[model samples]
Target: MTILCVRFQLPSAHETAFPELLGLLEEFTPVVEALPPDGALADLRGAERYFGRGAVELASVIRVRALALHGVDCVIGAGPGPMLARVAQRAARPGVTCAVSAGEARDFLAGKPVAALPGVGAATARTLCEYGLDTLGRVAAAPLSTLQRLVGAKAGRELHEKANGVDRGRVVPNAVSRSLAAERRFPRDELDPVRHRRALLSAGEELGARLRAVEKVCRTLTLTVRYADRSSTTRGRTLGEPTAHSADLTRTAYSLYEALGLQRARVRAIALRAEGLGPADRASHQLTFDPADEKARRIEEVADRARAKFGPRAVMPGGLAA
Candidate 1:
């Protein structure tokens, strides 16, 4: 099975607009591993034969399509597995796709820095370097017992496994992020408490809308408030019932925000996260007598329909684009 890891190299001009580019990638393969707002890893194992092209040829086609459709360049690494694919992509500069045959993964990784090995963070690298393990080849050749003594049993075993290019990590299918998040920063910090509340509400609304669209329900809400001094506090609430209802999400988010007590504070941004997602169809919504709840959901359905037809911004809740 061949996996292709494509790193979409977003230019400075479109840095924050990478999700738009990911939408383009989704056209090629539904098994896209979103690296979120930047790059993606695609399992193109079965696609090659279906497309009647070799992996290299398909990579070229993808590069051409990305350039033409999104006006973006990418570095694609093609290999028989995820680790090799990721390493191959790292070897390619922007606008190129490099394919490594399965047989060459070891040679390709051998002379690279130990730091190039995944999971070898700075502290580990420093420790390894002190022991003359500057390169992957050296690490691979080292006594596993010695490495354990240096970096502990677990880290050492993992390092020995990866340095020898023995990664067995599967390309996970149906992997969804544990949390759904929406965040917005003001062009300038604001001191109004009402505006901050509005920002939290809007973020909540966005999160809820996304959950509904994706057919998921979340069991908890977390709100993060960022202040002018760049410090922030996060508060969370467990929902009484799992829901994708915008009003419920908004109320929870607002309560979490208010709990931070940012009166007369310089607020820079607000972030809301919905956590512990499950299938929306499986979730049970508690009955409520509040007429306002029904009204808000009715309005949300209309907004969703409008956005589906006209575009995402056509019916955004207040404070999102502010």
Candidate 2:
């Protein structure tokens, strides 16, 4: 095993401390790449020789340190490459290190569903499965030309390579992002659409205020809805332009919620995450001629000033004023 995929089981309250967790991985390998919100990819090629320990052993140490020092637990997967490592990690539970040896890579992946492979979205998986190529083994055995004809040339080649355990992907060294998240939990399982929409509006308002306060703009917004059954659905939308505006955030959130087509879902919580963040000065807003739009922005600026002088709740959206 040369690569390790580590995913932390972090509490929502500690989401901001994700960078610190990335630093912890760096102690073991300088090749740690931060996967924001709660995960990381660490290449242990140098560390294995330096520490005289296998990747799985080092993963155990990482798990222990994260729990003992930060009171957080992590699941890890170790493999010969990044793609295999990521696939292994999904099958691992907390406190476990699911390691796939080089010799066992093909056998390990053969039984998994096509969707289990990274980059194979629901639509693609469905298309492949319809033709009896539901498993990695089936995909690997299919004729290259046949596969290409089915999913197009480029996607076909990549799919075949992954199925055969050929991962040319590398762990890129990346810094932690300025991701911001906010969540609201209902007192009881909420089945009301009106209440859910209100919660989303409140979350958007909070996210916008926080981004403006930090002088940052986000390029995308992600919505996660947790249901009473403990299952969840998540979707992300990229904005037309980077923004720290409440209206844009709310509109994106609403679009995502509507796409879910939830019919009386018992929702326990709603969370919104703003990602791809950058300096507000470096971002641009589209030029508009609408007087109403310009007026709204002016009013928003005044409200921001009031909130800064008084308190966070001093100026709030009408939906959340109560």
Candidate 3:
């Protein structure tokens, strides 16, 4: 079975949005590993039979769907594993699919730059190139002891194995989701915490709905604020308990925002991530004595139902940004 990694070079416009692209991959297969904005890795072991086509055909459908729905073209690469597939996509043009069969995974990787190997950054690549190990083929052919002396024992060993096209990883289909995150950037920078908080709430609400849909609950949440100056801050907290409740997630997100004490930070965008996910059925909910809390939850459920039928804006919380 081959793993196919689909790399979508989203236009600069939609580079920061994740949810829409995630939804698109969910249509092809639920076992998608989202790489955010640009790419995704999908385990296509079972999809071949289900889709009645080869991996290439499956890639074609995904590419066409993305272009039609979002105006983004996808370049897909299929190989025996994630590393090979990802590298293959990098060699492809937009809207094209490249397949590297298991037999050729090694040969295809050989001549590529050593930096093409994952985790080999510029510094590491330059260090390797200094030793005349510019291409992956050279790294793979070099003695393991020599590589260790040049880079280090740990990084050298890993690079040698990867350059030789060795990846022992398997697609983890049922691993408990680690987190749910969403972010949006404006066409123009805005410096209003109120607006920022609204976007945060919107993201939390969407994440909560997704958690419910997936039958997962989260026990922690994180908020990241990106400023126009390329600076950012991230804050996180454990929740009272695991929950897929939108209202609870929003409250936690709001608290995180308040803690930032932005005061007058020029914020460009905001992101919310619900982490530590587990089966919703296994989560224990705390009983609430506050009438307002109960009332708000009930209203939230009603809003969810209305949104389900009439669209997301059918109901909105007070103070929502226009």
Q: lDDT: which is higher, 1 or 2?
A: 2
Query: How do these models rank on TM-score, best leading?
Result: 2, 3, 1
lDDT of 2 at 232: 98
Clash count of each predicted structure:
0, 0, 0
Clashing pairs in 2: none
Model 3 per-residue lDDT at 318: 67
Candidate 3 residue pairs in backbone clash: none
Q: Write the per-residue lDDT of candidate 1 for residues 25-49, one digit (tens) a residue.
A: 4333435577765667776643443
lDDT of each prediction vs. the true structure? Answer: 0.75, 0.86, 0.76
TM-score for candidate 2, please give it.
Answer: 0.54
Best by lDDT: 2
Provide TM-scores for the models.
0.52, 0.54, 0.53
The reply for model 2, stretches above 4 Å from the true place, is 177-322
Model 2 deviation from the true structure expressed as Cα RMSD, one decimal place: 16.9
Report clash pairs, candidate 1. none
What lDDT does candidate 1 reach at residue 52? 39
Sorted by lDDT (best first), the order is 2, 3, 1
